[model samples]
Target: MILSPSRGETCDHCLAVTVSIQDAEPWCPHCEWNLDRYEPARRPPEFGWRWIDRRTHRLAYRLTRDQFDALVADGIDRRGPALARVVTIGASLLLLVGVVLVAAFGVWLVVHDFPSLTIPFGLAALGLAVVLRPRFGRLDESAYVLDRDQTPSLFDLVDEVARAIGAPAPDVVAVNDDFNAYATSIGLRRARVLCIGLPLWGALPAQERVALLGHELAHFVNGDVRRLLLTQPAFTMLGTAADLVRPVSTFALPQSALMGWAGELLAEIVQRVLARLLFTVHVVLVAVGLRDAQRAEYLADELAAEAAGSAAAVNLLDTLLIGETMEMVVRRDARAGHGPDQWRRSSEQARTSAGPILPALRQLSLRDQASLFATHPPPGLRARMIQERTAQGPAVALDQARLERIDSELARHYDRTVRNISWGG
Candidate 1:
């Protein structure tokens, strides 16, 4: 389907009407046309020298390309969550084994009366403790948490969508100024929180809002919330390990300049080696976590399409491209003393101005090959998936009056929040 153009311009290549946010230049979706023959292509998976690279990408996704195709063809229940569960369990077990090894080493050193070894082992255990300790200290403190009483209509809509999708309603809902929406679990109890970026929320059309909400809510059903809870510790542990080996400044050394210089030199050399080693480990952990995260994103997209219709789902993704440019426009206008009313107008104008640059942005993005670290698939890939799996269904019907009421409730809060946010500060 041709996306509604941001500026309502017809594609010159195909003479077909295009959606502004959806069609990035060089390639026209309507005609399957490419203007640039030399554009970098997506790299093919290789099994020989690039075995680890290939395995990383495969491990990151819930299904292989062929499996996704088969799943789409057969119309079966998604196995993403189950597959992700196995991967998460494997990662956790690996981490547990490492912890056990470290603890055993520390105990052996203590028993053998090796002060030097025991001291390092004790520090290692302490660092590991810091890394593995789950933290959700400031989750709700950072945002404006909404009460059901404060947003009855919005809660009503959320409840309706949750029921339709068979996902639990989020325990906490909040609004912020970002141009994104996400779900996060907090604390040991793993309470779910849904945060909606007010700027993005306000900018979406009513139908697209349904798509966005469905996409975020679907994370709960797809086990993304639980997976994140399980996997984040690996990243935290790696970060802690990095910090433990990071070089300390030698500037505070005693008054002897020669001694200080030698200390500084030694510190720098040690730091450089340790940094490289720690960074390699960090990269591997990120690679392991990324596949499942990306898979979860695609699965969520599928659920969103199922709940909100293919068109809206595609539009929502397209809007993400537009949203990036919108943010730049908002920041520029804000600096120029544009108030909330002026900011909204400037955002619309920015959306139109930024449309032409999207194709270039997309082309630039293609230069970076897919990796385990990428959180989402490239826009072109996601768009194609949605198009290929396009299902014919009506979006969940929302009461227009309730939607309008929700808008009113959000507008007041958004304006206040945006105006108060000091970007420079």
Candidate 2:
């Protein structure tokens, strides 16, 4: 560790240089700064150990003197280890047990034949598909670069924060009229594709844009991006099955209230019976979803702030949370009939326009959830994160006026988006 500059006084007990001699007590923080000392002392048992941050109920880091200094110097990494594999193992074991039980029972059902492990295997395969859909459903493009003229120069901003935290760069750009952005780990390679709503550039300052990028970047650096993607399909399948059979998210399966309880009890018994032969991977995944979500989000936000340097990111985040609630009339009606491309375009516009410092954002809706939530974190949590960091120590940055004017031109286009009442609303 680089030693601090020589200071006021030296310690008598140890050869440590102190930054200050304000208090009466003698404790030199650095190498022997005590001008006069009596009994020489040895270094403490734990030399350069300190707490860095927290991970899901566990203290996540142990910092040495040098590493701690490095973090503060290079800016701290916001992303941390995700306990995904932990959850994965838990789910897998549970499922394995269920598979064994199911396979055993299947054999017992036809003991003379004693050959029906196929049933359990089929269930496991189904679970695999649902669990890994995030990877499986990705576009396999070698890379998707933005059109040069259409490209936004978030490169500088994204690079600064990403380098600070050692996160991967976003590969996809959604340069449209939305305020939304998402980080997804896709394909076998787990490449991250970040989609940003174009209009936000005008509304948010350059640093604010960086902060948003940082938050999204945190998803990649943090395990949440991966966890959410990989576990999502399983989570949805198991939860939906539970809701349909036992009523976890929606109303109980069709039955009288009393009968529904009986139905749920029957379902539980059946589930347990099947579990003996089936895998609990989906069940455990379904159970731990929300807890993981909240924890991972915090780490991402903190990291984003560190990268962007202060609460400046918080301002734009706040704008999005507040302004996003409003719905405006726009011409996207031309691209109608509830398709993803249209929907993605609409969602992105609202998110970008709502930025606090945004010059403008086109009309886009933020309320659609049926297809969107599966891939992205909500904006509310991001807004709160910006607020929290600002309460502690806000990051600040300086930008050129010419660069800002470029953002302004982008803003002007949103205001002129045409309406198409001809299509269904």
Candidate 3:
């Protein structure tokens, strides 16, 4: 549904066409002005005072403020959260056990029980096991993957950053259209895939980019429970199951006779109850691992500081705080036919414009807090911690010339990414 500018409004940034679409805020489609305020209806609320969320938030804040040094001093160790790791791994094992038990029971029922009704029930149970089976992480097909051979300079920089932090370099790097970047393990071998988001990458400074790399690469060795092989599958499996089981609506129900309607209603209730249960368990798993997860994040930030310097690391966190604005600017430029060439300048301008408001935004972060279920600590807290600690200069710095060469190598990927952005892909 395309919405035309009703009031003949133009974008403040580029004087381009502006419009308000259904379930979206009024914003310029051409230059993306006012788009920062445009929240998509599809996105869920990011933070709330729900039981687990609230508890997690409180715990995160306490860790950030009261126990910051103690955690830093403790360093990365298997002993940090034994019970949490045990519970998380146990949950994953139980999921696997559940699948095997269900499949075995189904086979027994099919082989030994009455074939008429029992066979159908047995097949249904087997199908349920298949649906609930654990899955390993895999790279998204849409991602533009770059190998070391394809991007030597970029890989060299990554290798340098990994060496600086004393961590393993990613096996592969993938670029996507997301507004954020992540480092995750994939396949049975747990090969690390470093996913760099074009939107965020385009907006960051060279040193901040190095900091970003440092932070993500540090995750490889930081002992992040969620990323560990033993617990990662459980998180992936449970999260997938939770997403598959959503509240069923009455209006979506099929038409039926009176008795049939009652039976369907009972079934719907059971389904909804099961959905709620899955979601609750997922939430509990997140809550249980929240502290250790947050500790890993802070530790990663510290390592990022060591790898790229404290100033760059803190600045990177600030950039993250303004991530939404940066995304809007990048999208605006891409849609305006300005493309990647114009993104850095526009993003710099956006960052400059945000300076006055950055403090307020940081305060807002403290007041509202980050989501408890999130893997990282609050951006504001992360930045503050870096600043409060001793300052460190970059151990492995990338000169401007090398940075440009790396960009030159990634130019084609950036162009493809920008094209996708323009088409709303």
Candidate 4:
């Protein structure tokens, strides 16, 4: 992914720069002129399977999106103790019961004096229980956590945004050098954390920052069942179990002719069988979550409009849709040894310069079905929805002075992020 320009060559669309000969053909680093044309061929396999699972995912996406849209169109809002929620609760309970039953069975077998079975079956059962054990999402200790005492202005902004959305303020705020922001609750205590990406934050206008904050914090109160305490663990457990049981490459067998070959073959068969079963269940769980997740996203968008304004929310979606362009700006800056502030300045310049290409990018999003399998709806669709709504002024405004204070508080982290991006961190 080195960015280079050959002699007498420039991007056809942006005329900014072209990729190196070693990189993919006809790809422009600046405007992503022809990137979408090769997306299908370049997409990797899912769930350790090839075309079969990929096709399944596409089908699931279509069905889920169609259903969600139709339901919304009919003014039918399904949330709170719906059938999906019930199934989610039942599924989690069943998984827990299965784990307990397996552990109990293992213990009973060991005490029944079945020595032969004890070593193989009992231990295997106990091991399966261990792997299937429920997971509570844990706090990411590796993240650069912003201390409240040190970054009070930033925390105060977050608190204001949370209040605007009628959600509790996050217990922690962390920063990263990515193109996204997210909110998640960790551990049994459900301590919520708000993670902001410096690249995206720096690129955003102040009001749009409030829009971004509103969208993320709204996840807490938007009936997003995937983020719920009980269903969240259930939604993740099966996929994790499948991953844990997936066999390594069968091609890398032992050198031994007889004993090793036979043992490896048996283990591989068992692992593959278990993996398939777990993956099937995981797909089902994900399918169940999809419709509800899609609904939650649209609702969160509405809340974002309420907190910020319909125009700002729509503007935020437009900014998000240009993620590839922003990425190119960063990549080129990294190679050119641009200073730390270049991220923000270059990003805004790229965005502004590429105005003519923005419409095509939006159409490309719809053409590629880019957000079909994603948690959120397509940016184009979200923006359109926001535009259709009655426009409201910002309920929680971020004035230039306040934004400057917030920026001052995050100055060190921003510098570190820029340095990391420049040095290829």
Candidate 5:
């Protein structure tokens, strides 16, 4: 459906396009360029820009090549993966060490005749697989067609690139308001869909949409999705263990963040209680071997960029809106605010074809750790990567003024809408 108009025409501030004569109405619904700028809607960012996924570079709308490059390099943090690999090796070694240690500790439990959880845990594992397998089966049936319309949107573009990387088509799809696309396993290759949210596709430019899809597809092709699922049982158990350790750490007030984090990770040490002694060795063995989750995200980004070309990666941030902090939204309404509909909208909106695709990364505070870690990489890191090798284009900064105008216009439109309703009543 075509969206309605604002109070008047002439686009409030700029005379570039008027709402009165707009084909779609409401200040040119087909293209919602930044309102504050007097510049042409299709202009590039003032500074030259470089895309992060590839080694090639370009001039941005305005941001300098040197400055942007520094930020991008700083933003990406693959250090976690390196650390995780070492930990995996160390964890493996600890399994062997833990066996002897646990055996000594078990003498007390054995003599005291503590109940054996071996059978219980085995039963639990079986029960869990039984329960989850059906769920997976159900997902296989529904994931591809779950959406009301299942509009193919970016999926077709995604499939083109994903096939090269060996990813199958998604079995199901969900259209929501958010700017994200994720794949969950369904049963036996039937309906494993590459679900795309409508809001995201609608919001971004086609290239940006392609980039996003390419990234999600990479997750499937790289077996990241499967590994994620397989780790669930262990991850759940570890989470519970972490919860238990939280109190102990708080009670002890370990000297530093490292020690505190280490204490919480004692879930690793505690879970060996349920598994075989041999399993404990395995646990420690593989602990550091797995890629860091954050690193995996970066890897996926790179893969997507490569698949679609760096240009896709270049405008990715533009399409993504920071929106509300998930924590805040959860706290406020608990359910209504972050509902599926809103999520889908966010996704579709991120694909705006007119002007820029996404909103800038909203900087929350000087010391907000949550904001920095909210995305796969810090904004500075991703932004820098794109601008690293370039020196000419419209700077994304120009959008700030336009965004402010849109927000004000939206607010006014709503206010008038309320006044009209009250008067009629």
Candidate 6:
């Protein structure tokens, strides 16, 4: 029998009754569960940028999948290193062009004295810089940064993974309360930082922990981190430009009756036209960048499999589905005034309870239409790629005693973080 979720219905997974139906899919905002699976079968073709992106992504997937399978069959593929160079050069050029455009506009304004053009050009330049600038100030506020002294064992494990992958070690390591892990490059120097979510780490087994690290550290090895830094700015700038030029309500204009209304209407029309143009540019850039991003995900998965066996890598991906469910449990427990220890136990319980449905949940996500703005490919596709290419082997061996010690240390950090965290309603 087929199952479907209705409006105002409670999610079977999270038990939240606030499920909203969109396009016939029941979505739980609190737990992020989509009850209905999205199937893209023989629908009418999309027009414009989406159609172009659909074709581009299909080609990218084919090329990258072949390279990934070949890498698994033999050894590391040269595509990763070659692509890294291309990304770095492309990003540098893009940033350079933004700078030149702003400079040329400034020179033109000064020489020609075009005061009327100054506002738009200035806004565009500011928007470009806003998109391209790297900000790291919030990192300190949101997560605890660990130095070698504070997390020696954890650093040691990270170093081991870096050596295995032949990539540079991250400049800093941080721990947060979330159920996800990510790597980022910061500031003008682009210093690398690896952030591990404490709750997610606590939920994983030792082998799976290694798999998670392998996947994240592989980003550096495959140059995915650098590529993101290069390609993301244009897309960001375009979005920012659109937002900056979007029309404001006429009601907010000066109260001069007819004159004010007419002037506001004219300005609104111009703003909307400019905003649409900027949005179109944003869509094109996003479509182009998505192909690169999805390819990087596949390459990173291959590197992860090489580092931690096929089974462990695949297990890690499966575990991620449970991580979302576990997060909902954590939040629910926290709201009920549960302490840190209880939160940890609740996480474990959620993980166990989710085991049966994890596969189904992942399949649902895979069935969803691949969006032009998504950073990674569908999870089901990733699983298939892993199964096809990854060979079975023992995960990277770490001393059990040291692993236990790191776990204990992180647990303490999690307790402190939970206690100090404030959830303002």
RMSD of each: 7.6, 16.6, 9.7, 7.2, 17.1, 8.5
Give the alpha carbon lDDT tens digit for every residue of 59-110 in model 2: 1111112222343345433344335445744554554455456555445555
- Model 2: lDDT equals 0.45
Question: Highest lDDT, which number?
Answer: 3
lDDT of 3 by residue, 297-359 (tens): 887898999989999998888888888778888898888866555887898887788776565
| Weakest lDDT window of 10 consecutive positions for candidate 5 | 364-373
Candidate 3 vs. true structure, TM-score:
0.76
Write the residue-wise lDDT of candidate 5 on 1-425 in tens digits: 22234454544344544332112223333333332122222233322332321111121111122333433566544233355444543443443344344444445444443556454444444443343221233433222243222323223444466674456766555433233567556554434556554334433444555567767766665534223433333323333333333323335445578876686567646644434443433343333233344345555666556655566665665444332332223222213323323433444443443233122121211112112112244443453455453432321111334333322333332233234333533
lDDT of each: 0.64, 0.45, 0.74, 0.72, 0.40, 0.64
Per-residue lDDT, model 6, residue 350, is 68
Clashing pairs in 4: none
- Model 5, residue 17: C-alpha shift (Å): 38
Who is ahead in lDDT, 5 or 6? 6
Q: Write the per-residue lDDT of candidate 1 for residues 1-425, one digit (tens) a residue.
A: 13344365566777765443223343454553432222123454432346565455445332334434654576434454555456655665677567667776656655666666577767666556546554553475557889898789899888877776778999999987776788877877878888988767766666777888888998887755234555655556666667767887645655578887787888889887987787777676665565566556777888777777888887777767566676666656555645445555676666566566655444323323344566676564565567787574645765557667897777668656556554552
Q: What is the lDDT of candidate 3?
A: 0.74
- TM-score of structure candidate 2: 0.48
The lowest-lDDT stretch of 10 consecutive residues in candidate 6 is 35-44
For 147-252, candidate 6 gives per-residue lDDT tens digits of: 7877788898888877776778998899887778988777657688889877677656666778788888878766553345555455466677688789866357
Which stretches in model 1 have alpha-carbon errors above 4 Å?
A: 1-77, 81-88, 100-124, 136-140, 225-227, 249-275, 328-372, 421-425
Of candidate 3, the 10-residue stretch with the lowest lDDT total is 35-44
Candidate closest to the true structure, highest TM-score: 4
lDDT of 4 by residue, 1-425 (tens): 23345555677877965543323344465565654442444444454465564565556545644654665475435255556667767887787787789999987777776665566777788888887776668766546889998888888888988888788888888988787888988887889988998778877778888999999998888778778776754677788888988887748655667887888889989999999998788777776675568677777887788888888898788788878888777767755755335666887787677566554454444425433345766676677666666777889998888877888888888777767876884
